[model samples]
Target: MSDGERRDMGSKLSFGRGRPGRTAVTLPDCDVPLAEMPSPSLLRDDLPLPEMSQPEIVRYFTNLACLNYSVDTGFYPLGSCSMKYNPKLHEDLARLSGFAQVHPLQPIETVQGALALMHELQGFLAEITGMHAVSLAPAAGAHGELTSILTVRAYLEHRGESRHKVLVPDSAHGTNLATVSTAGFQCLPIASDARGNTDLAALAEALDEDVAALMLTLPNTLGLFDQNIVQIAQMVHETGAQLYCDGANLNALLGQVKIGDLGFDVVQMNLHKTFSTPHGGGGPGAGPVAVKAHLAPFLPSPFVGQAANGAYVFEEPEHSIGKVGAFHGNFGIMVRAYAYIRSLGAPGLREVSENAVLNANYLLACLREAYDLPYERRCLHEVVFSGSRQRAKGVHTSDVAKRLIDYGFHPPTVYFPLIVDEALMIEPTETESKETLDAFCEAMLVIAREAEEEPELLRSAPHDAPLRRLDEAAAARHPVLRWQREDQA
Candidate 1:
């Protein structure tokens, strides 16, 4: 379109807040401030950047943030991803004077408050998870998994046992499989039984001297808590292997059961998930891994330890896994998590888990009949519904997801928990009210009916969005990371 036409549209009431699309600029003629800042090399010219006025830049980003849906803005029912409302109180507390301004290189004595908070957080997390110690050193959940695996490996290596494989349930998080592989252990999938729980028979068969650990996500990706979990842990123990609980779904069981009491020798919780910290594109996350007393020494340093003089200090573990990240965890994320923990206390946390489970079950009722739920049983904090019925009617899970946009709600996670064909995974967090869930259910059921009555509407969905479905294959094959035009001399 012509610049005049673009400018005309952008001057409207609604569009006035948005910027015109990026206008590519040629080098040497660039009008950005960086264009005047010369390169370090004497012979080189100044760096060229596209020139954008303040208003244009503001409008451009405003439009971009609107493109995204978050727990802060809407109901994000991404199962296993616990996109719960990040309490604003936690954000406020995290940024308090003492917490936010701490320097990483400052002497331990100088940052006593920061150190004490970390020490208390460690103790609180340990008590919550029923572990001997906590290491708020891993940057994110997956990083925590890596840290746990390394610790398990160290414990095994110390005993002169060289285990080669880590048993991963088929229902386990994809990251678990990847983590084990990256940590130099083979990921052996233990298939699920008819009950949507890990197949005890398969796990028993997979168990052997070579298996170092069995990574179990209690309420597996299907959101079904394995009833045989305790027995499964025992079986792993019998085989002389550690039990690693992927506590991503711990939100579903908080205050209900403790994984430590359930026989998880090493476990990692996505503090960003269960503890109500922010989660998104790139984190500021804390994924503190707790371990049975035996694995404590191998934890990442420097763990917060209480000194004799009533001061908290960073002390290295006996057989440390070294530093997981540059400093002690994501300090900012830890602050948020610590705030969440203190605010919710013990019983309050349990209620959060209970309410989360109740919400999921409530949402599931509205969907179970219209959609095909592979496992028709009590779910935890999330439920997985299949779009196989819709797919038969010529609408896919992806199409159904896009159509949800019209209802002013973010779509549930689609095509996940791989076992279910055309899966739509939903998690209505504890914070959501019954009304929001009912609306979500209504939107889902309406979409289900439309899939049958007007397959075309369901097929060519997301009619409201500025962008529509591109040929995904072509887009991926020739990804346009950024916009470009013919070279200008």
Candidate 2:
């Protein structure tokens, strides 16, 4: 079939073309006596199984894979996601037999090398974040947030304190609020100032002994760093509350600053985000939680420790939160992150942040005239622009995002950080070259111009894509998750 025809029938199953005797697999004859099958009621004869040959099945899935966009295929300027390209070297290292083949249940003495790697990774993360202890137990970025909150609760309870509120900034990620509530604390939202920093007056008004912690997303969701972070930390500490840093934006501060030194009591790093691991697609992620000395005792269990005999071993904290997962976090993701840190070293890591900041500012400078700047300041690793200018021509931020697909680029995040009217948050990671940045900027500008001249085109966009604009709301509210033949449907 032609490509267009294939695309049109992409959603259909592979059930119809199979001949009566065709099969993808051929099983050998049973060598022993057959076991009795289950009762008749337990089996369903109506279920249809696809019977395409092996090659046909492979070709069908391969064609589907080609339709998907990936960071490997193009520039992904996804803000706050740090969806940069992962190094192939790391992939190779993680797949080595010594690392990949070992079972998690192996005796500690038998897997000393893997334990040593984890031990060194813990120390490396501690040194990078300037924290007293690090626990590579949380499975993902949001998992790290939940872990840190639980640790804070444990520490507070140990002190016989019953702080029941967690202050979350209006600019924080949705997971921050959810983490707070999930940890059994009420989430109190703090507003952002006009300059895009946390509103100090509002935070001061909200601070009290009852506040357990203040969860701040450093550089926040707007992709703008809070200049008042130092003062903000002090305020939280004064109210007898811990300060939690959601270090998802740590890409903007790799070697520039350490959250521990910034007075944060605890911080969670998304190794998958900042450390160059593959992200998204419902990750196998690593979000290690780091803490100061006071909160160290409450860290999650099974952190790597070194004995005086120079052997690596697993040890639990004095006031542990127990195992957060079946094993010590995602081992494969940890390997990738460890490789990322060691390969980059200190200076290369610093350069990562510098280039990330420069690329973001470059895009900001090039496109500010075409779009609305929500916060007029130097952004760190990403820039959040308003699509209000395009909206004035009846093209919303989502429309602008859809138009970018036709320009052969994945759209940056839109209508997020909620504070901006028509938020277009863009993060051009350090990996992209100037040529790529310039191309993206040009496409964005072209889209802006088209918004004015051909608003309808933006409204019904992605004309070049295999599928046009979908009913996103309908898809969300009433999803069709399973597939069936038309007659059954």
Model 1, 60-128: lDDT tens digits are: 657555556677788888888899998888878888888888789987788998888888999988898
Q: Candidate 1's C-alpha lDDT? A: 0.86
Q: What C-alpha root-mean-square deviation, in Å, does candidate 1 show against the real structure?
A: 5.0
RMSD of every candidate to native, in Å, equals 5.0, 1.7
lDDT value for model 2: 0.91
lDDT of each: 0.86, 0.91
- RMSD (CA, angstroms), candidate 2: 1.7
TM-score of each: 0.91, 0.96
Which 10-residue window in model 1 sums to the lowest lDDT? 9-18
Against the correct fold, how does model 1 do in TM-score? 0.91
